[model samples]
Target: MKKIAVIYWTGTGNTEAMAHSVADGARTAGAEVAIQCVGDIAADTAAGFDALALGCPAMGAEVLEETEFEPFFAELEPQLGGKTVGLFGSYGWGDGQWMRDWKERTIAAGANLCGEPVMANEAPGVTELDECRALGEALTK
Candidate 1:
């Protein structure tokens, strides 16, 4: 079975909730899913997955969480070429620019995005979570 990693870092648990839904969707779609916090997993280990769903809430001027997620993502980015990746996050402010920039970065890294990145304003409501799930399912494809 395909092995997928649902990795994330969350300040307010918004992105964590999205990560669970992403993993659930992947499991439902018949893939083996490992859901983990960014601090708990190594970038190289996560990069070994058949597909990836990455989440981190927007922080400090609409950028990724600086301390943990950014460094982890930077380490993981080089391994993403030709990998299937899905991006999701929550933003309390700004116009979801973080997600857009993240998408561009992922593309520039040569990662094959599963679909549009999923974003929520504060906490993800039902729609955004469902979209996250769909993003997960797409990764399994």
Candidate 2:
């Protein structure tokens, strides 16, 4: 089975909900999934997974959560070469600029993106949850 990690950080719990949806989908698709908070994981832990689903809320002027997620991601980025990565998040404002920037960063890090990054305006609903699931299934592909 594919080893997949669903790693994320949440402020208002929207992104945490999204992460669970992603993990559920990956599990359904027959992947071994580890769903974890960003703070609970080490950067090198990413290397053990066949694919990654990363999540964080868009914070402060359309950027990633500065304190925890950003620094964790920065450490993980350099190790992403040839890795399969999927991204999802929630945003309160802006035109999904954070996701755009994140996608660019992932590409620059040499990750093989699994699918389009998934984003929801606030709390994700049924549609957004389904999309997150699809993104997870893509990681197994």
Candidate 3:
């Protein structure tokens, strides 16, 4: 089975919920899944997985969590070339500029983006959850 990692950072638990939904979809698709917080897994850990799903909520000015997720992601960026990568997150405000920027960055890093980055306004609703699942499923393809 393909080994997939679903890594995320959550402040209000909204992104965490999306992470679980992603893991569920990966599991259902017959992939071995590892779900972890960004702090628990190092940037190099991403190399071990066949595909990766990363999540982090939008922060000030619609940016990634700078103190943690950003630095971690920067470390991982160089490793993304030719890898299957999925990005998702929750936003309290703003027009999802973070996700758009993130998508572009991931592509620039040479990753084959699974799909459009999934974004939720606050806590994800059913639609968002389903989109998260689709993101996970895309990794299986």
Estimated TM-score for each candidate: 0.98, 0.98, 0.98
RMSD value for candidate 3: 0.7
Clashing pairs in 1: none
lDDT head-to-head 2 vs 3, winner: 2
C-alpha positional error of residue 79 in candidate 2 after TM-score superposition, expressed in Å? 0.5
lDDT of 2 by residue, 63-96 (tens): 9999999999999999999999999999986899
Model 1 Cα displacement at 46 (Å)?
A: 0.9
Each model's number of backbone clashes?
Answer: 0, 0, 0
Residue 73 displacement (Å), model 1:
0.5
lDDT of 3 by residue, 1-141 (tens): 999999999999999999999999988898999999999999997777999999999997888999889999999999999999999999986998999999999999999998988999999999999999999998888
| Candidate 1 structure, TM-score to reference | 0.98
